[model samples]
Every structure is written in structure tokens, then in C-alpha cells.
Target: MTPGSGLEQHPLLPWLALQHTRGIGPVRAAKLLEQLGPRWFLSPRLPDCGLSEAQLVQLLTPSWSVLEPLLEWQRQGPARHILSWDHPAYPELLKTLSGAPLLLFVEGDPDALSLPQLAVVGTRHPSYVGKENTRNLVTQLVDVGAAITSGLAIGVDGLGHQAALERGGVTLAVLGSGLEQCYPKRHRRLAGDIVDGGGALISECYPWEAPQAHHFPRRNRIISGLSLGVLVVEAAERSGSLITARFALEQGREVFAIPGAWQNPQAGGCNRLIQQGAKLVCEVNDILEELVAFSTAALKIHPPATEELLPYPDLLDNVGLETTAVDLIASRCQQPVQEVVTRLVELELAGWVESVPGGYVRARRS
Candidate 1:
């Protein structure tokens, strides 16, 4: 049946009812489905299903008002789809999770959901090094036919998606908000680019649901659930990226972390994860080695080429890993402030040093 058909007899109505029914969460709903099968929704009597009276009433008399927006959104375009648990396009890996969403509002290619994905997640305000690491690793992961998966947040998540697109690879972005209301607002174009590049933007929330603080942590599960493994480039000791790593561990997916300088706060969670047995990722092979078994594609390792000597060696030498003030750098290089500023711009474009708040620091190279 077409999605635009009347709601009263819609095939997906029961699934929607089950999803919105009070007290019938994913876990309990899964149990009910297992015991009664898909036909349970049409059954006249639901004996031994263990649902409360209120839940049964809600399921039997669904609030069609709550589901209208979803139907309208799906009818708007062919690329858009609302996938129920039994839908062929619904991801099997995500289905294995304990609290998997009953419906996924997807925009773009639903087939991308089935691709072998490697999740790359990290801090929203990642350091310069963290940004570089995310881009380089995501690019390499895409080369090996691994689709990148990440939340569409601003920092590392955005970088991962952009890198995958730039490398001409597929990337999936799971959202904390509804598909209609892209979170962070800034990455809305990135979200569209994902679709244009043959990827997808996914959300379990209804089309109108706004982003909430709790939705993000909940969103992390799908990121890990859809992937063969998760690579955490940089995260604080208490970061959302670590939450995705924890979910990866619980889901029996490999967890990989990059070691960072001890002083770097963003690396704390990764270091801790390594101590707790997450594989330490120095190069792409570190992750590829663990996930090769999951993919049919042959592995290809591309070693990084040698670093070329950066111009303005005297000025470059003055820029340390820590944020170095432009004035301080100029003083150390014994050059005028204007000359140093011009040279620093060149250095930045050449991938030598990056301008951060208060100064410049050497860019981390792969």
C-alpha cells in the first residue's frame, strides 16, 4: 500500500501506535512482538501480552493526530521513508540493540543503512590536532569501502561527515532532533550534502521533535549500533563520544581510540578507554585490522607520505604545540608583527600551524 493511503487502515498505523503507546517502550514492545508477532496489533484480544490496560487502550485507539506529521513528511518525497521494525530497509544491526527505535525517519538512501559503517565521533570543540585526526582517519576509512557513520554535531562529527563526502564516500548522520529540524542549525547544509552524496540523515524522533539535551546521549547508541566498530579521535573524560564507545562495547562492536598528549583534556576519555581495553589506534590499519573480517572488500593500507619541510622554518620553530601568541611568535622569530602575521597565514594554508584563540599552534600531521 502507498504511504499516502488513509490512516485508519494504514499498515504502519499499528507500529506507530505501539511506538507512541504509554508504558510500551522498545524493550517491552519487542517482547510483545516476539510473543504475539506482527498480527498482535490486529488481534481482538491481547491475552498474556503483559501490557498495562492504559497501554492496550492507547494501542487499540491510537492518536492519529500524533502520526499525521510523519505520514505527510514521507509523502513529500521518494527519498524520505519511515521504516518500521519489520521494514526491509530497517538496519538489522540496529535492530539487535535492546532499545532500538520502532521507527526511523530517514532522508536520502535507505540502502546506505546496510553498508558496513565505521563510526567516527569525538569532541564538539576538538583541538586542532583532533580535527586533523578525524579528517585524515575518516578519509582513509572511506578508501577501504567503509561507510562513515556519526552524529551530525559540529566538531568531530561534522568533520567526519565532510571528509567522507570529500573523499567521494558514503556517510550516515544520525540526529538528536527530527529529520525536519536539523540540530546545531549550522550543519543543515552538511545534512543536505549527506543526502546529495548518497548518504542519509536518520532520526528516531518524530519529524517535529526539537533537539533536547537527553536526545543526544540516546542518539549515540544508533551511531555505534549501525557500525562494525567506532573510532573515538578525541573526547574529554566525560564526553558524549565516550558514551558511543561504551555503547559499541555493549553491542559487541570493536572500540578504537587515539592516544593524545597527557595535557590534552580532550584525550582523557580515549586514554581511559585504552586502559580499559579499547584498542589503541595510531594509524588506520590499527582499526582496519580489527574490522577486516566484517567486510568482503579487500583491505588496502595507504601509508602517509613523508612530511615536506615547511617554509619559514624560523617562524614555524617558534610555534609550539601549545597555543603561541602571534606577538610572542614574532618576538621569538625576531620579525615584525605584520611580517609574522603574513607568514603565519601562509603557514596555516600550508598545514604547518593553525590559528587558535590567543595564538597559533603547530598543526598535527598524519
Candidate 2:
């Protein structure tokens, strides 16, 4: 996974060389790549660098000791490869964002990071209601075949992962900490579950980097950047969830907000997003319709299985009928209510029926 090994060029090598240099940050590294390339650290270039005369002294300074750990790291293996902006594997969506991570030290499946993604984000300290809302909506979205992405922090993020797993879908966990350490210690098991279930655990931080305060806002940007849109399930006025919404706005990705009861303090930020014109999400269809319209493709959804249903009729013939209750349908079909409920769920997912207040309504066929 050494970046650009199979390609004709490695633009990031020059950038990473500077990244390994002390006193050079993203702005400086980008400047160096534009000027002397990675050689900026080795050779001396004054005019090519935008650095003022005073800045040149600092820029020219050497810090080989700072690179000792990195050199040793490079010798280890493909299990870790540092990715810079120019790596072919670097996501195209990520390239459009400002200050994409200078290096991505990835674990699990790196390919999953490049998929067309929709980020599901919300409050880390979610209320009970918030968790349920996240689970239901995420399940619906996954059912329609959109991959779930989130910063695998606690609360709503963890719930989204669980729901996607239950729905037999893929999810990506963007970490605020390093690959080696799982934050919230409680989610160590859940993190394993995510990787075991065909998703990935991702981070840009180097090994053993702890979840510091500064890391999360930076992490928030990646959560938004990797997504076609971001769903904010719930958030307080000043919560970190707002950071992701802000990044989504700045990154030009769609920002979706789920409205909740005004009586709940946790709903404040999402309510504000709605007033400010973020989509007011009520169901997964609301999201899928918008997504399919934007992406200009039909959702890759598979129909539910027969055994998972109640052995009802060819549901198409049952279309355009009056609404019917689960209990009544069970009696009509001579099946248990649970079986009837399952069939109705399958039909509803297939878009042949819509769940009404007290019953299921058949969709009118054209």
C-alpha cells in the first residue's frame, strides 16, 4: 500500500516528506509541494517558497530526528501505508475538501472508504428517543442500499452501526482516535462488530493517538467530507454534532435534520437546521427520493424474502385497497399477527403499501 507504487507518480511523497519536517503544517506542506516538492526539505529554496525572509530560516531548519519514527515505520509492512493527497486510493470526494488529511493510516478494508457514502451523525450524548429515531431511519436508509458512514463515537453513531448491522448492510466508522485505540472503551466490542460485518474502521491519526479535543472537530470535517449528505438525528444547540453539520454546509454536502419535539432540548440544533432549510426528514423514503434524484439512479434495493413474509397474495393485485389493520389482515389471511406484520413490512418496503396510522394502506398502482 505504499502510495503510488503501482502508479506513474507519487505527488504525496513530497508532501509527506515535508509533513515529516518540523514547523511545516498543511499550509506549509502544500506550499512546499507547489515550490520545491519534497526536495524543499533537503535542498534550500528561497524564492519558490512564499515564506518571508524571517520564515525561511525556520523552514530551512532540519529535523531528521523527527523522521526517525517514520523511517522505522515505513520498514514494517503493508499493514500500514501513509497516504498523501496524490495517492490513487485517496478518495475523489475527499480531494475536493480543503485540508484533507495529510496522511491516512488506515486499517480494515481501505476500499470501503472510496464508496459513494451518506454520513449518519448525531449527538454523542443522545436521549433514549434520539437513539430509537437514529436506529429506525438508518435501518431504512440501509435497506435502500446506501452505505452508512459515521464517526463511531458513542450514542447515535453506535446506534446507526447497530441498525445497519441488523439490516445486513455495510457501514464505515470514522474514528477520532488512532486505529489502535477504540475510544469510549464501551464500544470496543461494537467496533469489532463493525469490521467483522464487512465495513471498516478508519482514521487519519497515527498509531496510539488518543481522542483529544482538537481531534474531533477535525474529525467532524472528514465525517462530512466522505458523505454525499449528512443526517443529524439530534443535537443540542452547542453540541459537537453541530460541527459536522457546519462542515457539511461548508463542504457543499447536503445537510439533513430530523425534527423532534420542541419540548426536548436535544432537538434544538436540528430544529434550527429545518428553519434554515435543511430537509425535515420524516422517513427513509424522504432521504432516498432526494438521493436518487440527486444521484440520478434508482436505488439498488432487493425485494424482501417470502419466508420473511406472511405468505400473502401477489401484493400487486392487493394494491389500491382501503387501509387494513394488522389484526384484521391476520384474520383475513388466517395467519398470526406477527406473520401479517412481517408481510406488511415487506410489502411496505417494496413500495406496494404505506403504513398508515392504525393500519397499512395499499399504494395505488398506475
Candidate 3:
């Protein structure tokens, strides 16, 4: 739903009441949402808690009792709306996660929240390879129409934001802290670029909430929940990146990990994830191929390859990935080197090939 549609005429109001009932958390909210449809949620007709006696008490007491603050927030108009549990804008990806947020306090660009997103996360201190891979991947992902989502941390996350901006693409930064104070303090510039590029900044907590260590793990769930998949560029064995990856698995979103050198400490978590069945992404195609089944953005934003590069002589298709020199290409087409070189230049301009150290490498555009 759009911003103003949060609880207006929806059955979500009573569910929000159940959430505000002082100790009732997500697990409890799920049971009650199904039980109380659009009517009064506190009705005595509800049955006994399926949870154990101890769990029952936990369910009855609203763990999230900030209903008044939340409602007051909604009263402020749609500028800062809260996406309730049943709203349509609530990501379909998030619906799969257990203990999903009963409501999400939204900030800027609510419309984009409905767009397909790919979470890009990694260590605060990424290695050279990690940074390069992230930049390239983010550019390609955005060009293919997937909005980049990251924490805007110093390393890989920062690179993702920068790449998206450089390519004139959109991005979303999920903050561990409130939007009032963009964390890392240093990334204030990068955050500006994101917003300027039509990206948004979001968090599960309220606007005044401050960043804390504990808030990060919970923030990971939102990162995973917003995207069709979580892409880990680089992460240490116990890094926050892994936490987001774990949440992706739990949320039933695909988990894609970029492989880094074994000698690098940051690659450990991603490599381990690959061992546990996460898709290993060496390049953007690996990511695109995996996401194609779920999204058609790749088919739309990605430009077609040039005629010279067509694998089967079809200008609409990519000249297959092959190993051939400019000389071979010229000879095969029966054209002069200068003529062939000009043709290749045009193809390169259209994102079909790249000049390598000794020859050209087939490149794909998104």
C-alpha cells in the first residue's frame, strides 16, 4: 500500500493493539493476525495459546508496547508512515521470515520500497579485491534494475553506494542507527549521494533512536527482508555480514556470496556460506542468472549486445563469450583491421566487449 494506507480501514489496527499489549512480540502477533482478521483483536472468543504455559505469558504481554508513539507517528500524516503487518508495501520477501516486524516505521521514498532490491553487505574494512568486486557488482546490479541496499559502512558497503551513484542507479541504505544521525559519521557524503540518486534510507527503529551494537543484528533481518537475495561481498567469520546472510536464509530469500582469496580473513564467512549452499557469485552474470527467475528487470534494463559481438549473428543477442583476437575477427569478417577495430569500438561503446592486456574479452551489459 501507499504511505497513507497503513491502518486506515484495514484489519491491522487491532493486530497493532495486540502488538502494543505490553510483552507480545512477533511470534504472538502472527497467531493473532490470523485469528482476528479485521475485527476487534482482544475478543474473548480467541482460543488458548498453542505455546507452553511459560510461552503463553510471554505471548500475552506485549513485548512491543510503543503503540502510542507508533500511532502518534501515523497521525503526523504520510511523511513518516508505519507499514503495518498486512499492508501491501510490506515486502513479500519479508513475509517469509519468522518474527517479521509487526510494523516498520518508514522514511523517504515509500514508493521505491516496493521495487525489487538486492542487499549488498560486507565488512567495514574490506580488502582491495572485496572493494573492487563490490563496486563492479553494484554497478551491474543497478544497471540491471535491482536497487542496491547496504548499511553504508566504510568498506564494501560504501563501495556499493558509490558504484550505484556513479552509474546513475538507485540504492537504499539500512541504518543500525536512526535516520537523524547517519552512522559511521564519515559516510555522510556517501549517504547524500544515495538520496540524490533517488535511493532511500530506512531503519526498523524510530527516527530518534540511536545506533547501538545490539541494534545491528536485528537490523540485519530488515536488510535480508527487503531484498530478493542477500549478496555478501566480503565478511569475516563472525562479521555482521554473516548475520544478514543468516537472516536471508531464514527469510527464504536467496543468499549469494562472492568468493574471495582463502588467505584473506574477510573471505572466511562467504566461503563458509558457499559450503553451506549459498550461491557463489564470481561476477555479475552469476548474480543475474540466479535472479532472472525471480525478476524481469534484467531483461529490460540490460541492453542488447552489438552485431559484431552476436554469438549467432543476431544483433539482439550477445556475441558469445569466445577467445579470438582482433586479427581473427577481421579475417573472419573479411574486413580490414581499421574497419574491424572501428566495429569493435562501437560494440564496446554499447557494452559488448572490452580491450584486455593482449586481446579483447567478451563483456555482457546489464
**TM-score per candidate:** 0.78, 0.70, 0.69
Which predicted model would earn the best TM-score?
1
How far residue 33's Cα lies from its native spot in candidate 1, in Å, is 2.1
Model number with the top lDDT: 1
TM-score of candidate 2 versus the correct structure, residues matched by position = 0.70
Error of 2 at 183 (Å): 1.0
lDDT of 3 by residue, 182-252 (tens): 88899988877776677777777765688999888888888888898999999999998999999888778
Q: How many collisions per candidate?
A: 0, 0, 13
Instruction: Give me candidate 1's TM-score against the actual structure.
Output: 0.78
Cα distance off (Å), candidate 2, residue 43: 12
lDDT of 2 by residue, 166-275 (tens): 89988888888886778778988888888878777777776568888788888889888888899999988887888898989998988899998898998999999989
Task: Give the range of the ten consecutive residues with the poorest summed lDDT in model 1.
Answer: 296-305
lDDT, candidate 3, at 151: 82
Model 1 residue 178 lDDT score: 93
